[model samples]
Target: MRIAQVCAVVSTLLFTVVAFADVKPNQLFSDHAVLQGGMSVPVWGTADPGEKVVVSFAKQRKVTTADADGKWRVKLGKLTVGGPFVMTITGKNTVTINDVLVGEDWIGSGQSNMAFTVSAKVAAFAGMQDEDKEIAAANYPQLRIFMATTKKTYEPQSEISGEWKIATPENAPAFSAVAYLFGRDLNQALREPVGMVVVAFGASTAESWVSRPVAAGDPQIKTMLDHFDDLYSFYKTHPNATTDQAPSAPQTINARPGKPGPLRDPVQDQHQPTVLYNGMVHPIIPFAMRGVIWYQGESIVGGKAGVAIYPHVMEALVKDWRQEWGEGNFPFYCVQLPPLKNSSNNPMVREGQAHLLSLPDTGMAVTLDVGDPTNVHPKNKEPVGDRLSRIALANVYGKKIEFSGPVLAGMQIEGANIVLHFSHAAGLIGKGGPLQWFQVAGADGRYVSAMAIIRGEAVVVHSDEVVSPVSVRYAWDNYPDGANLINGAGLPAAPFRTDSQDALSAIAKDFTGK
Candidate 1:
């Protein structure tokens, strides 16, 4: 009797150990889980290669085999999203994921500002306020959150470690400020369950977000490559054997009393193609997102490949992301970098962002009037998210909402002055007085703030010093403190240049022409 009892206990212990060691559902199971409404949605996973796999969801059965490399995929036939369903997968072992939800999914990506979390900004505490009850009460049973960890790799990756988490006020503070706000809008507008996969890395350049080989195709990309190579060489030669591994040594040893180090981290400027995509984004490719929103470009501007190559890099990013996502012409909405000090280098990048808008199914949110000259990470994320959502609502989702502020259409040289025409200016009224950000210049090519007046559908700009103006610029300052040219909806028009010039003026000219 004693021997039999001991045998039973040992058998039970062995079963439990095997069960625990078996694959717990790969939380990064699927890049996308479509809201089962009309057609079949694909649900896939990776396991020991050649293992016979079985997937069971809501009485529906699907089977597939692990590929030679241990990657396996299976598609669940079309079903509906009205389920508190459970998903089970079996191969070398069985894995069950509970409280699974099927719903609308959105991909939110970009750089610092877009990645800024509520916990890090001024509005961090505001989320708990009674006024922000909507955000506070955002505990949607079907809403799911997947956050992509920051990564940089030379090649694309197939898996990452993030899972679907239900959204609540408890989970809200850590969410991406911009992405969370955008998702809030979608959740409210659609009145349906929502899923969001947020992939944002702070201070990343546009090139980092795109594939390397593709971005390198542009001759302009060589400058960035050369700059990084030089920095790498410097570090390689000056190897700090003792403290080199520390992140602060490079800055500490190469610094002046009060100024930044002359030699920045050689790695800081290494804007290699797909490095970030491989590490942070590769694990989540082809995520079934309704659209994409971008807020990057600042890092690229300070390097050797600055502003001039901004547009080409943007083009590459759009193309590569779309290709990897396997969706052609996906709606790519971007934020027009906010205004800054006269010394800021991002104005050119902003122009590059504007040029990207001319691409199919693309949109730009102009924030020239909302930037803080001293703060690179602006705190006014509400408007940014709203404007982005407005673009998606109008263009991608086909909602009949007005999407943009006034855009400079053209300038007609009439008499001794020029009349600037703007598009999307349905009710073009200066918020306070006549457009105060207008500037004019003559053949000698000197620009001065010009007197601007609303004349019918156009704004006539003139300067006393110049009787014949050849060029016109509006809100062209790096950071115009008194810029008041906003439409009735409180959206600002992007800065624009009519006649190109040299130096900083030439940079503005590059974007105006593109």
Candidate 2:
């Protein structure tokens, strides 16, 4: 009996070791997950060398063999918009994922506002407006969230640390406020399940999201890279220097249990070069998402080059993400930088965001009026979410609703007055008071405040100081407080300028040479 007991203990130890070394699926493929519907779902993992793997989900099954490196994948056929399905993956051992739903999936990526949770309290941060109320009322099961854990790496990471959770009053407080509101509105409008994977970092730069190879290859982006390299060299040795902090502290993005340390080389942190995309964005690729919504650029905005290079960075990101996902022309939307009391050229960034509409299948959510001049992270998040949902509803879902504000279409000098033509100009009028923030400039190019009133479908402006109105600017400053031009749909018109030789635009040209 003693000899038999010893043999049994040895056998149990060996079995446990083999079990731990067998095939494993990503945590994202686990229970309570939402897969993107209407697309080929990719199931992947690793196993023993040359192991035959089979993945079965819904009514479809696929088989593939693990490579020499133990990596394997199988692509399930396109699925419809409905599921409470179970997925089974079998190799030497079997792994089963349960209670998975199939529906719309989107990625929300950007800076602090994108990272701003309905409830976050820590350094370099503040909580969302009415945080407690928003958290207590949350009870949506279909609006699932998969928040990618923060990990800044110099090289691309294959796996991230996080799990999907159903939105509840308990868990919703930690979810991204904009993402939650957007997903809530989306689910309500589509009447289907919606999931958002937020991979945002506070105080991150645009260059950080673009890969080094891509940035090095592009002339315009390379300029920004060179400047960052020079600045980081100074910041690393001079620890107390006034440089932007790393992309984020691990605890800031998620309320992790233990305190985390800063990067070994602060210069190569997530805020620098391609650190963000390498660490945060890469681990999440090929997840099969519907589209993306972005809200960032505050850290990258500058006087001239910052604005000019912004459009290029936007183009790089759009191209890079689409290339990574292998999805064709997915909808990309972003929120414009709202008004702020800080003395910076935020309008330049806003204009660059507006210019992104020139890209195929891209949209912008104007929030000029929705901003709090005193606060960067505005408390009014519902409107921002609703506006984003409006764009998706009208453009992607085929809903017949006015999704955009009055877009500047053309400018005409109608003898001593500048007449502005607009798209979606129906019911164009100032709200709360008379029209404000309109300025007209003459040949000498000096702008004086002007009187603007709606004339039929256009806004006509005139000023006593200018004889010939060559250019017109509306709400064209860091904080245009009373700029309240909205369309009939009540969406505010984006801040704009009608001059080709404007100082900001000219400075941008000097840097970008475009």
Candidate 3:
């Protein structure tokens, strides 16, 4: 009887061990996935501790042992661009991932703009222009998208939830509109499979997507961390406090407030620094991708301080993401906020965004002409995506195409006028009427409306109000309605200012309440 009882217990223990040892890959490695081509692809998962896991895909095999904590990873060599292949993982259990393709993969992330979908099916996402037609025509099987589930956490998470879906008419409507259009353009141009991994949250601040370490190190944005600490502390002390009783979270400038909830859960607030990165971005690190395309800055916090720190925050984000991904200086492109009225979308924010050009391998899609004065979320996303793809095609794919508009190269004071030189100014012309929105300022630091004329790859500006023009500014307003300086390629010129003294004075005024 004793021997029989011991046998039964041993048998039960063996079954439990085998059941818990079933190998499982990350959600990103499921069926219909697209592996990045021309780079080392990282495949990782969890298995039985000390188990030897072998991953086989497209004539390449990689082997690695699970760590003491049951984590395992293997890097496959560079893959050529082609596949409808199957990947199999063997360990204590066998897992097969089907319909995998090797192609160019890119990350598309930001706030609502990046999260906007192609159809109006979902009420949360404002659908883009030509929704029905765009959705009906979406039948590209080679284009795949993995939309990461929106999540927020106080600490970095090791696992995320999402799935890869091919671009069929049924699925395309739900895909991010900008990402889909960008991928569609790339797929058409390169004649290869393209994948877009979209991780974004609506009405979230840039600081919320930054890593905790990076956010804490920056003095300009460190207050975000302090606020989080205070909120977390309050939650810990008053675990049962209602939303009304809890300390009110600081409102992000021009951001829509989130639904009220229990204060014990700090992750519920998307504005908290690093929460989105912790929950959404951290789990997908080291996934091989060509580059990232970002669209944000409309939800900047801290008022003038927020606008002031935006460029630095974005710079830090780009650098930090590159470092984390182990991809050296990958192309980082962004969209300059378009014109809007009575909102955070202003000249200062756009100027701050332009500072990203100072970084290497970076580009900005100027959207001065694509904005809706009444709505922050413009329905027109076709130009935005096309411009982003234009940058990638020209720089990454070696395509001969105009990727940007006229950029302010330098300014020369010729007589009583300022001549603003520009690159990419081939056949520069005023679209409708004479060049409008130009302002000239003199030593008194006062600006007055000025007339501008296109003069051989440069715009000559002068004002009878200011005889000696020391500085010139073009399209410098929240809603530059008539600003229509475009290059030969018909791309509108980006807004620019020749001097920073006025900007400094504005900042001073903001702080001093003068």
Candidate 4:
């Protein structure tokens, strides 16, 4: 009887030990996943502490020992882009991840537009343009996608929930519209597998993408973050004195009565600085990728002040992401905010997006031609993706193609006229009609509509109201109704200014004395 009892206890303990020792790969590692080629690919997972972990794929097998916390990883060397192989990770137990492919990948990050799906209902579930057609045609098995689940956490998380999904008619309807189209173009152009990891939250601010420590460490961002804490503390300590009104929006909060209102939990708040990064981006660090394609700015483009600080925030984000990846600088391309009705901030945000060009390997896709002033979220996404792919082709795929439209290079104060010289000015052309949105300002710092004519690669501007035009602006307005400037490549020129009147110009002068 004693021997029998001991045997039962030993069996129970053995089962528990085996269960704990079993290895489990992250949700991102699964069948139909694409491993970035031409660089070291990292494969990581959790296993029993001190257990020997081995990863075998294709012709290479890497080994490592799990740490005290049961984490292990192996870096795969450069590989050629063909694979339909299986990856077997073995510890005390084994996990077989099948149908893995080696290829190029891009990370898609941003707000609503990036989160918009090909077949998802429109703003009010009205249905996206060509929803049925696009969903039916999504048959690219070689192209894989993974969208991070929406989550917001005050503390950074080590793991996130999501899975690799193959692009098929059955599953493509819900994939990010911009990301799906972009990946399709890339895979077709490269004639190899392409994968996209879409990690974005609709209506979230850029500050949410930065880690809390990094955001709080910056003096400027800290000022913005401090307001939230102050408001929360004020409310929590004096609940009866909460304000009568909600103050229109989240940032417009007031502790007027000196009490808490509805207890808006900042801990789970999506707008809270670093929450999205903690819940979404941090969990997937070190994933191999060629670059990122972003379509955002609506949340942060609140007004002049927001636009002025946008470039700095963008610069910081790029640098932080690069450092986190541990890979050298990678291309970061963004889609300029298109024309918007009644939204004075769009143009400023567009200028801020253009300002990011100062950073290396950065590019912008101008979408003035495709914009619909009536709708903030434009329905035409094919062109958006094609334009982005052109940038990638020229910059990353060793292809020679015109990837950008004309950009203001210099301004010559020739007499009363301002001759604006442009880069990438191949076959620069304005529309048949009179130039639109060109304004000239004099010493009085006042602007009036100016006459503009395309002269070869330069556009000359002059106004009767201002005899000596010291500055000029083009396509600068909330709804640049008829602004038409493009290169022979058919890409629209980005909105720009040669004047120092805008908020961005003033900040530049004050900050750099330029």
Model 4: worst 10 consecutive residues (lDDT sum): 505-514
Tens-digit per-residue lDDT, 1-514, candidate 4: 6999999999999988877789977777888889999998988878899999989988899999999998888898887899888999998888999999999989999888888888755334223578799888899999999988888876778787888899998888778888999999999888999989999888677777887666778876676567656655665676655354323233322111224556555546655577788898988888889999988887763455666777777777877788888888798888888888856337777777776676678888888877777776777888889889998988889888888777776788988999988877788877656667889998887889999888999899988889888888878887888888887888777777766444334222210011
The candidate that wins on lDDT is 3
Task: Give lDDT per model, in order.
Answer: 0.65, 0.78, 0.85, 0.78
lDDT, candidate 3, 1-514, per-residue tens:
6999999999999988887698888888999999999999999988899999999999999999999998999999999999899999999789999999999999999999999988878645478888999988999999999999999998898788999999998999889998999999999999999999999998788878889888888875576687678778888888987666766555543222345665557667776789999999999998999989999988875677677777788888888898899989898888889999855898989888877776778888889999998988898999999999998998889999898888776778988999888877898999987888999999997999998999999989999999888988888899999899998988888787878854433221211011
> Judged by TM-score, which candidate is best?
3
Predicted structure 2: clash tally: 0
Q: Clashing residue pairs in candidate 4, if any?
A: 241-259, 242-259
Q: How high a TM-score does candidate 2 get?
A: 0.86
Candidate 1, overall lDDT?
0.65
RMSD of each: 6.5, 6.7, 5.4, 5.1
Steric clash count of candidate 3: 0
lDDT of 3 at 319: 83
lDDT, candidate 2, 274-309, per-residue tens: 778888888777887788999987775344655566
Candidate 3: residue 485 lDDT (0-100):
96
Between candidates 1 and 2, the lDDT winner: 2
Output the better candidate (1/4) by TM-score.
Answer: 4
